[model samples]
Target chain A: MLDMPFIRIIEGLNHTLENVIAPEVESTLAKGQLFAVVEILKQISGRFDHKHELIVEDIQVSQQMLTTLIETFTAAAIDIPDEFQANTETIDATAMSGEQLRQQRDRLEIIVSAALDLLNSHRAEIVDAQKVEHTVFMQLGKNLFRNMLLVSQHRFDKISQLDKED
Target chain B: MALADNSRLASYLAEKLGGSELSISKEWQNTEGWSMETFSLDVEYTKGGNKIEQAIILRRQPVSGLLEPYDVSIEYRILSALQASKVIVPETFWYEADPAVLERPFYVMEKVPGDVHFVTQNSDPDYRLIADDDERASLAEDFIDNLVHIHQSDWKSLGLDFLGDPGPGKNSALQQIDYWSDVIERAGVRAKPLVTLAVNWLRTNAPETDQVRLVHGDYRTGNFIYQHSHITSILDWEMTHLGDPHEDLVYVLGALWRSPAPTDWVCHLLSEEDFLSKYEQRSGISVDRDKLNYFQLLLDLKAVGIMATAANAFAQNKTEDLKPAAFGSILDLAYAALAQHLNERLSSC
Candidate 1:
């Protein structure tokens, strides 16, 4: 599992809270929250197992979109500056670790974002601006959908369970 | 050091109040919120030949937080200015900027009875649950009333001109953009194409503000205390600043803060239409849809900026608390929400 190492630490804390702290705790608030911590830890441990895959998938999607954004701008007869052309290469997700993948994706996103900014600023002057905007929106929609899917998979309801003691 | 414990705090307060016979009846540290260390306590003391008791809450800046470091005095000043305003806020007593008083700067305010209800993620029994329809309705009205009062107040006349006058006209929107942009840049998170696009969009379509009022930058649910279905006090003014009123309205009406309730109540109390209409009717300011949309994007960017800082703090081991780490995990969600909003606005444009 991607989170195996971190999961071990969480498990250790959960074990201590259950066996050590909960037994010695006097106040119900502290006791209940300790147990809740254990529950949250368990949830996080379970979630982290697949989080690397999710990250990898997101990176792959972003990389593809970065490439597409460049192509779309080119197709729209938009001048691609030399600096903005940097890091337009496709990233091989399989060869990189999750951290490396994130780094690579972040680098690629920076380039694409510059391109987006250029396009947005010059959009009014472009005759086929709608086409360019549509392509950018489509790419953004892919990322947004991926993000929503991943977030929906989260087991912990941060809103409902976070302020119980307040 | 736990300098805010019961006896130590009681001793400090006794001296501050110019009294001798003083004792703490209750004291406890609140472990919520990643920004500040909060301690709620009750103090009983003899003052001017009379016995008196008061509940008080103390807030201190932590060693590490989710935003740029700030002095507690700013919050104190804002609260002090609002004391005579229609905005319902707790009474402030003292502020200690010197780190010698405690490990960090701290301020004390009245410990208003009632608890902030965060129904989305917590099930704590301490918060007063509003099951009665009548009570819920009453709380909603009060919530709208407070917000309107804040937006309508003459902040310039309240001696709050220190909060940089965003000049005249649309300087409010531009000023807000500059402020959040600086925060996001300072956060030093990995740049995302989405945030860049959103920021540009904000700049491209910044709105004009006719009036500049105190914008409760974090005006949403979980920031207010309620008792008997009444909002006792509006809390957490650390992010308070002078800006467009629509900014606060956008925060209140944002989708991110919505509960799972039917009609998806704005703050688990009022419907969106009701909230907007009540605000307009009460404040006498018409709701500007374009301004709201622009500020909503700004708010989303602010959320991402904060998450970036939290994530950076945790990744750097600057804090051991899990709250910042937890907040970090939601960065993706904020990004997605921002991207979605951008797509919607751009597509329509």
Candidate 2:
């Protein structure tokens, strides 16, 4: 991962902020913010080594959730689309970049949304459709929370309201 | 600086004001807001053989913004209408639709004197909105009173119907759902299953409006200006439109606007009970808890829409400003809040 060009780009940003941009900014407030940017760049560089591992783990979780959801719907005799069933089969997470893994997750999410919609369309008539829908909704909710936690693992708390010190 | 040429703006304003001479000095530029670039300037001009000076601001729509390819003229008309009403807003002066002047559409208005407090005083030493506890309580009272005034005013009387009335029934909720859904689609971000589910839930549970009033879409803390312990003017009407009043109330009460303290103060000004009771008493409208909760969820979805738009703009390289990109950084927090709200709604279901 160190050989990745993005890491070098992050390094260059850090160098420029520390050496060039921070010095040119006149306001004390602006300079402090510029240095903050430098710090963020350093943080990004620190994550490069484990970036793939994190993305793979997230993709694995998403796939596992979708696979379970499909089996649950099938057991309930709820008809899901053939394409939706096929997409959740597997993904080459190890070979994929973070962006690609995110795309895969998004694809699974869309499938889950379609399945939920299908379950809901007949919720009034189908005897146990409500139960099936609840189960799918709960699983999707947990998946979203876990995925968000992965995405924001390194982000800072939002800065205190404008001009107030943290 | 977003303002390309200082002299061009000066010349344009001089002609507009019918002044013999005019000079514009840049006083300050606010980098906090994402949609509009706020530039404060001291304008000195000679008009009718009298020299006059005043502080004003230029809110210009940048190419890369939270809500882009939008008409600044809509905001101009809303403010113009509200100026005659009870809502405390900046005195709008002019609206420039041509992009040639400042490279984008911009408007000029009087710069009300004040600062915004984002953090609670106890948490942040620099919190300067109000020092005394009494003044703080008064400001909260006035804040609710101002909101009541806004809610009570007749939008039709103010000639703000050009904002397109969403009509009666559940039309208001449906219209907003359609609008923000379009924004999310245009934003073209990765599929957000939670947002999609939330939108579905909102559609399924769309509430009927008792009355349609002018709804300030972004009526939260960090959007208003405070001076001497009183709110001088409510700023950021860019998202203002005709909708259900509950929309505004829900936005004001959202988690994003509150202090981290244990108090249930809305915007760190008034307690929840006090805010609602005062609003009900002053506005003569009963508070609807179910509708408030519904809109709270929708507002969170709207926030996700905003972040998606910002992320889209950042991805498209429309602007290199870090602010829009920074908005994307908070998706996790927004998602967590949405999930909590979703769980609550599911339990009721």
Q: Give TM-scores for every candidate, taking all chains together and pairing residue i with residue i.
A: 0.83, 0.85
lDDT of 2 by residue, B115-168 (tens): 875543344434433457887887787788788888898999899899899999
RMSD after Cα superposition, model 1: 5.2
Predicted model 1 interface RMSD = 5.3
Docking class of 1: acceptable
Which tens-of-lDDT digit does each residue in A1-166 have in candidate 1?
A: 1112466546655665687568878999999998998998899775453345666655665656566666766766778877555565455667876557656656666777677777777777666554565566576676567666655444233523453575
User: Deviation in angstroms for B331 in model 2?
Assistant: 1.0
Model 1 C-alpha lDDT per residue in residues B60-155, reported as the tens digit of each score:
887665875667788888888899898899999989887877778989898888877653532333333356779889989988999888888888
Q: How many residue pairs clash in each candidate?
A: 12, 1
Cα distance off (Å), candidate 2, residue B132 = 1.4
- Span of ten consecutive residues with least summed lDDT in model 1 chain A: A152-161
